[model samples]
Target: MTQAVAADLPIWAALPVALLLLLGAGLALTGTLGLLRLGSFYERVHAPTLGTTLGIGCVLIASMLYFSVLQTRPVLHEVLIAVFMTVTTPVTLMLLARAALYRDRREGNDQVPPPPPPPRGGQEEGPDGTTEEMAAMDRAELAERR
Candidate 1:
């Protein structure tokens, strides 16, 4: 490393990078732990976003600061990286969960709720109609159809 670059990074500048790196690591670890400990698929899928959003954010900001100081110019690559990560993480999680659900459903697993039963032909009634009235109306409609 050049002496000029080394001189630019004083203790004050390095402090933010150190704090960010540590914070980012801790958040990532917490997210991983949550992923492991969470019981359900939805919770597990959501846990990693902690790492993707805030964790990566801290680390990226630190990188941007360090590189900018070293290069004597604004380093914006990390900003792009952070933005790309934020946009992609949730979408990726959703796709993966959807694929998993599809596979489970294809195998006839009962992991997800089944489709609702088809509607029966009956006289349209408002919310005031009772269950017995609906059943009678449906029966009359069925008899008429027959």
Candidate 2:
């Protein structure tokens, strides 16, 4: 009896649901390919953004559709999660990129732009006749010194 009831459930919706899942899979695949094909870390970062945004969007949409249909009620928890992810992912990516830039600069890596040259006047002298410039060390130079 349960088998008949389950079998009688509308199967037509599967078409749309499957299509959505396939779309999500394709987006994720493309994003992965972009991550591999890109030349630099900065460029590669954008690839995952696509997957984290649109790929997840499609999957969430599919989940909402499937659950709503099966349960005969609107399922919206996935929507909230999707919204939160979309909002937070970019912020996280930005922070990571900034951190990478900071570390690379500190390491004096050639891949990133060098920090601005120190102020002129050979170094500002303090009241004690010591140079103020010597008081604060350049991050890259300090790292090299160590």
Candidate 3:
């Protein structure tokens, strides 16, 4: 079947498609700026994730709409692409976060919290029913000993 060109589309369908494409491009650009401008890895990871997901969604929806109209049938390949991105992006973010945290802690970076102490058997819990006080006390004793 011959494909319908953009110029041949009725105004009703063309306007939304054009708007969506522009919006998608804008969102993607914003994300790119965020990635470049953010200072920290933690802060930086979020921008692209949100930006790309929403941006791509807009672009894909536009493509789906334009093609569906052109072919006079519901074009759905974009759905698969959207689902794949939605599934992968968050998983990638988490993995990168964990890896960065691990590397930072290994290098003794002070920004991240220290690893929790090993569990002790039969240790009396503090009034708050937590080992927080005990850990603090132990840390204090170690400091004094040194």
lDDT of every model, 2 decimals: 0.83, 0.82, 0.86
CA shift of 129, model 1, Å? 36
Ranking by TM-score: 3, 2, 1
**Candidate with the larger lDDT of 1 and 2:** 1
Judging by lDDT against the true structure, name the best candidate.
3
Candidate 2, 35-85: lDDT as tens digits: 999999989999987788899999899889888888899989998989899
lDDT of 1 by residue, 1-146 (tens): 65553545878879999899999989999999999999988678888889889999999999998988878899899878887898888798889998877777788888677644445655567679898887887677677668
Q: Candidate 1, which segments miss by more than 4 Å at Cα?
A: 1-8, 108-111, 116-146
lDDT of 3 by residue, 9-107 (tens): 889999999999999999999998999999988889888975669999999999999999999999999999999999998898899999999999999
- Per-candidate alpha-carbon RMSD to the true structure: 10.4, 9.6, 8.2
Instruction: Using lDDT as the measure, name the better of candidate 1 and candidate 3.
Output: 3
Tell me the lDDT of model 3 at 108. 97
TM-score of each predicted structure versus truth = 0.68, 0.69, 0.75
TM-score-better candidate, 1 vs 3: 3
